[model samples]
Target: MSEYFNTQALALSKSFADAAFKAHTLAVEGLERVTNLNLKALETNVAATVDFLSEAAEVRDFDSLKTIFPKGVNLVKDSAEKFYANGQEVFGVTVKTGEALSQIAKGSFEVANDSFKKQVSAAQADFSKQVNGAAKKATR
Candidate 1:
């Protein structure tokens, strides 16, 4: 009886540990993806800023100013579009990670519940057998 209990306990512990590890791995991967996306965005922003500054510095007359103004407007529009796209990518990663974590939790719960039901059924059968044996001996 003790051995059976010990085995069940070990199985339950291992299941919990495995689920936790999976969750941790998913979370770390999601974070890494987001970090990479942000880094790339930052690099692009810096390069764009430097290029725009270089162009603006060369302005020496109205003709140069006219050309720089249109380029500056285009730069702002492009930057906004890039920012929106990066935000969507981050959100996608977050949603996927959350779904994976939820699946882990659901699977763990189902395993534990099934184990509990089996243990209860076994205990009930053992108790019934003992009771029947005691009644027969008393009658004899």
Candidate 2:
């Protein structure tokens, strides 16, 4: 009985550890994806700003200024769209990671619950057998 309990305890411990590791891995991967997306967005934004500045610096007359103004406006619009898209991507990663973590937790809980039920049923059966044997001996 002691050995059985020790084995069960070890198994449960390993199960929990495995679940934890999986959750951690998923979270890290999601974070990595978000970081990469942000970095890319930053790079694009910086490049666009630099280009716009360079264009403005080249302005020599009112006509050139008019062209640069429209370009600047377009840049702002494009940047806003990119920002929104990046936000959506990050949200998607977060939701996916959360769902995966939830699944890991749920699976661990179910496994532990089933193990506990089996142990209880076995213990009850063993107790019942012992009681019947004792009663028979007493009658004899």
Candidate 3:
């Protein structure tokens, strides 16, 4: 009876440990994805901004450039703001998710550690009992 209970408890403890590891892994991966995607988008935006400046600078005529400048500036402003807003939104979501996952992992670790300590103590007690029983039998 004791063995069976211990076996099932062990399995439950292992599942808890696995859940903890998976939670941590997901948090790390989620953060990485958010950071990578934002960096890539920002890089593209910067490059495009630089290209726009270069082309605008090369304009030989003010009337022609003026004809183009307003639309170009507006386009850059609108699209860049959208990209930055999206990056912020995604980054915030990832941070929140990661924090929640981290908390779950921490809780799981505590539960697993407590279960392990109990299991070890029970095993030790059982060993002591068996040894005392055997010595008494031998003395008799």
lDDT of 1 by residue, 1-140 (tens): 56557767887898899999999998999999999998999899889989999989999999999989999999999999999999999999899899999999999989977886787688778878989999999999
Worst 10 residues of 1 by lDDT: 1-10
Decide which is better by TM-score, 1 or 2: 2
Per-residue error for 75 in candidate 2, Å, reads 0.5
Task: Sort the candidates on TM-score, descending order.
Answer: 2, 1, 3
Give the worst 10-residue stretch by lDDT in candidate 2: 1-10
State the TM-score for model 3.
Answer: 0.56
Q: Each candidate's TM vs. the true structure?
A: 0.85, 0.88, 0.56
lDDT of each: 0.90, 0.91, 0.77
Best by lDDT: 2
- Say which prediction, candidate 1 or candidate 3, comes out ahead on TM-score: 1
Model 1 clashing-pair count: 0
Instruction: Give the per-residue lDDT digits (tens) of candidate 2, residues 55-136.
Output: 8999999999987898999999999999999999999989999999999999998998788778768877887998999999
